[model samples]
Target chain A: MSVLVFAETTGGGIAETSLETVAFARGLDAEVDAVVVGELPHGAAGELAEHGVRTVHHATGDAFGAYSGAAWATAVQAAAGQSRVVLAPGTPRGLEVLAHLAARLDVAMAANVVSVVPDDELVVTRQVLGGSVLEEMQLPDTPALLAVAGHAVEAAPAPAPAVGTVRELTPEVAPADLVARVVSVEPVEAVDSSGLTTASVVVGAGRGAGGPDGFGAVSELAELLGGALGVSRVVTSLGWRPHHEQIGQTGSRISPDLYIPCGISGAIQHWAGCASSKTILAINTDPEAPMVTKATYAVIGDMHEIVPAINEELRRRRG
Target chain B: MTDVLVCIKRVPDVGGEVTLTADGQGVDARHVGFTVSEHENCAVELAVQVAAATGGRATVLTLGPAEAVEQLRSALAVGCDDAVLIEVCEPGSYGPADVAREIAAVVADRGDELVLLGNDAADTGDFQVGIRLAHLLGRPVVNGVRTVAVTDGVLVARGDGVDGVETYELPLPAVATVLEGGVEPRYPSLKGRMKAKKAPIDTRAPRSAPAGSGRVRLLLPPAQPSTVDVLGEGPQAAAAVVDLLERMGVAR
Candidate 1:
């Protein structure tokens, strides 16, 4: 049986995550095909060919102009005629559409899966509780529906490129399926700090920052370090930080090279988001806090005083 | 008047290391406290607000063990007018699909036009039930929503999409999985607590059989070996931190 992957697009090109997902599908030991909804992204066919995708199903029309989970699922379902296994990127839209597709097909789907071995029963390894735990799962039924987690596999080209023949289809979508279509889109608000998930270094603040006014030192440190600012769940819940900057289970998961969390009592939820970081330096007055104990480096002190000192030291070293 | 049904789950408040049970089927909850997830807290808050503004009934539901009544009562204390618990033998063992089916069976006839749930359960992180339930009930769904309100029979749900803040308007009989940070979940007052203590919980058994999601085991990730080097104490540690940063190639 063939494998079908939903190719998600961004900025007129295929998303990096979708390429990674295509690489993931190639490892499934099956002929890989792709389905792209909306306008076919530029250079998408050539890119899929390099990734060993044999067929590219392009589903586009007036009905596909807007983002509708149900309508998108219908297109994906229509395209997934012969493929028993379907995969999508573990992104918000990908997961949403897969959930809708799983329901429409009346099948069980696994989300954020890192590994899968197809057989009579599909064996999969998936991250749960925000990557802190790995669960080995089995899909008992046919047509194993899965959402591949972000960055689970490296994006690579095949040894030999495939034909990448493009096929077009007009999916019959009912008006009822477009019931939840997007009405409007408000542009993203400008934030002072860079994107947390894409940053190389992240400076995190938590309850130990004292209060909203206490973020001055840590904010300055983040700027001086040329890094983004991140905060723990409590910071957002307390309104000290915005939701986008919160690095925790209910927030963004980051995998930066260096992470310095100040005054954060590393709860499991918070750890789940930042655990993927390569190096962690925790600053907390309580040495026994989880953040301190689990960190590669720990400083036993108040962040209010320690952070500014670190900034001063950074400046001196730069001079 | 619109009726709002908020579904919640009782998850262990995992503050530290998550320990699995002897069977590896569930989390070892003996040491940790219990509470709903952050997203669920906001869902409960939104439900209470919608019910209050519309002069409608707000009901809390859960397909969990008998102890989940605690979560139900907590929602009641926060202004939910009613509670329903579909008691199960093992709540953790139920997959997202099974949970959705059970919920669909429970609320299908309740005439609840709006349903709210956490974007994903705190423990399982399935992120499937809300959308699945919507499809099962033939209602429209929107997940990862931060703000939602029903006005003149249309449910306006706004969420952070991949590109920007997405707004979706669905007709009555809809589902939304809420993410935290939109609204502040209020604390229960003394009077609300008293009423919740006396609230009547309608408990029942699940109608559908558990269709396993094929989960064989839950394994904690191998711990990263970390020996935290102490960088002195107070501001005295700053120089040492910068030195280390220099060594790590982060400091110029």
Candidate 2:
């Protein structure tokens, strides 16, 4: 069986989530072929090749310059003709394109999938009910479409023998498919913690921290420990933190070595995103908070006082 | 005149407490009941408001099982001039891309100059639908928009993000997803609801692609362990708490 994975891109480079999807596809041990749409940079295909992808299908067109669900779906459907399973990161683009492909192919789409196994039938596991539940479904049909949720798996180092064949594929789409145009593309300007993916220490906050101003203390503490700052869904919802900074069911899932959470109540949705952290330290005023019970170490105190002191202590230790 | 198409989704009510099963997958749907997603209703209201402002027409489209017609009628009750239901084989299973494609087909057929959708479906909380739909439509998309107004053939809109609120002015024939609290969603009046019941609805099967091989395994979340803590009342108690906190090294 061959597996075709849609490699996602942002600003002409492969997205981190797409790399994680590549890592997942490698585990399937199938003839893994990666389909990259749009204008890829010089070393893009080579980078994917390093991830155990044997073939790269590069689809390019004027319409492909921007993300069009219809156009991308057309390209992916065409690419999936040769593979048994089509996989993509459950990013917005991946889900949209895959959903269209599933409709075009008249098949079911399992989204936010955590696991996939090929046996007599393809079994997939996905989180449903807002991360409060999980569903195990069987896709009896061929060439099933799967969108793996972001951060479901860590991106593994590419194996040796970094050589892969690049095949050029162009999708023929209708005028309606080209209706949407990208007027402009701007990269979000914020602290890029690409290195934080491997960081040992992580400090996170929740709605209980208050708002954007509340994040100042968390950031200071994280900086003191040379760690990264993460937030819960409420922080994002309140516009105090970016969606990218959110660490909940619908946000970034992290598994840092030591995770410190301040004023976070640790709802199940939030826990699903960070339950994998090695050691968790929760500090909240509520002694009965879910986070207090779930953490490996719990400190019941006012976060306003506790967080600042922790930062002060770390600074003193460094001096 | 501006022609607008608003897309909506009917999902389970979000206010109720959710229970997970033993396998750590899938929610217990037995107690769950359906309602029009809150934000989607806002989208419909925003579209109706825009149409009222610009002297245009608003058409609502949805993809679901037969039961979804109730939501379409509800949209009509809220002031939508027309509604279309694109019947899907399985309602909740179809992802945003499928719905977007189907809606795109309907939009293409309906000849709408502008399209609007909720920022994200409350049930899935996947905020990519509008962007993806814009991508599929090959149109400019503004997401998380809290306010929108038309001025001299340009649509001025504002969206809230982590950094702050962003304002955009774009040409017509665009895709926008309405944010929560953008405007107060209107409830269906008795007269409007009765009129909606009498309105005709168009039903059809939107084009769909083949199924993907991925299977979803449903399981519930783990049971939450209980805990209890007692703190004495009154502002005079603050000093003792502070002292205890200092002893625990939580305060200076």
Candidate 3:
């Protein structure tokens, strides 16, 4: 009758993906209860309460400091006894913990679920074949475990309920559970974003950019339109860009309002990551490029010349 | 002396054309043959390389059906000193956690100083097994590992992150998930393959209690709608097609 979500946190705060999971659980029509396993940071509990979480269970221990699959699985198993469905984000920790919990509870678990609905059975739709395909699934059993894919759900801000409660559960773990400790935490520098996920415009590159130097022109065009820079797996493989900036199957997926792909052949894996963009413009010299077929607008010209011209036009329009 | 366990999976080649099953919950194995997964092979190779460098023995461990011995033979052919197949469950019956538990039980039974696995399996593309195994064993884990070298009483490794490669030095008995391009995986020679066929392989059921991971309803990808638009040949025709695309607002 209720949904128990394992809210993931880093540096004692809820992660953006966890909030997205919270938003998804609201659509399941189940009472949402969040389980936080460590010390709640200031105002963190308040944020969860605002999202219609009625109960927050805080399980505290030195064993819970770092991500321990067994410890988290034990906590989730204990929590699942009271809930109908247990949910977590399809992040590394989320998938790991849920995998263990599913085994411990002797229940089935589905990973990277895009959508779930209650019916005769728990009907779920998930991506398969590296996002090239969508598969619909039905899990009729009780206490179903599901890990929702990251970025698949949008975090919707909801008003806090009048009342919510927090309680603590002490997990039973051995000394070995404390063996793996996080010695330190380093935060990555945050970049100013026109919100890559929600941005109205995006510019993506691929191996066709030639290398890191080629990214200069793509970056310039992105800046002109106040958009974000994206790339294919090849760019990441070549080490020309960081993995976070890669916009393919193995990297951060985006669904911007307008997507402009330059000097890129649209592979199935890459298209799976960006197919959700509202409008697609492809600029490739290869007239038969796969991306050209998918694009709402196609420019059969040299990207080196076309991209710069577009950038100049946007700059002039801005000025 | 140090004990090393390398966990590997026998996965179908993902790059090949695949056929769907009649039920759509599994892959058709008729045309699909198994190979040591790209990353898992690297993990096994790394363990063998380290053992050869450090004067230790490398044991390859896997959990799958009886036919998975093909993968073990492949590992042994590559230079693994020994092999163990934990026949606890079939492939796809368990998720990463179940796999982690089985691996942990095997590790505990065998007593290993280090553990290694691929970053993700090729079939499911779930990259959490190595990390989860470490968490289950209560050991430190490093993901996306590139280079690994043994130091005095410790192991030093470099891993790729969201940013650049990160180097970490940890004591023995850590888990590492090998990444692509970490090292070129060596192919098994004819002599090595012959020796592997004669090699002794230890097979047993894992001792851990079963964790009932839920079942997933697997289905094949939808058929793509055919929209084959073959443009006419010649550069002039290509230019005309460009103009047509521009008129359609596809190109600017």
Candidate with the greatest DockQ versus the true structure: 1
Residue runs of model 2 more than 4 Å from their true location after superposition: A9-13, A158-162, A170-173, A187-202, A210-216, A226-259, A268-279, B3-5, B13-17, B20-49, B57-115, B124-217, B221-252
* Per-residue lDDT value at A186 in model 2: 38
The local lDDT score (0 to 100) that residue A306 gets in candidate 3 is 69
Q: Output the number of the lDDT-best candidate.
A: 1
Candidate with top TM-score is 1
lDDT string, candidate 3, A230-287, tens digits: 8887887677876557675545567877788887888766776787786677778877
Per-residue C-alpha lDDT of model 2 across residues A1-319, encoded as one tens digit per residue = 8899999765656777898998888777787888988777777787788887888888888778665666787888777766878989976567767755765566656777787777877887766645655667777667877788766788875766447688898888777655443334334344244333455677889877876788777788677566788888677767787665777654557778777787888876677678778767777777777777767665677777767766665555446
DockQ of each: 0.71, 0.19, 0.19
- How far residue A166's Cα lies from its native spot in candidate 2, in Å, is 2.0
lDDT of 1 by residue, B105-156 (tens): 8878687989999998887777799999998898888888988988988899
**Local accuracy of candidate 3 as per-residue lDDT tens digits, B113-135:** 78988867766665667766776
What DockQ does candidate 3 have relative to the true complex? 0.19
Per-residue error (Å), model 3, residue A281: 2.9
TM-score ranking, best first = 1, 3, 2
lDDT of 2: 0.71
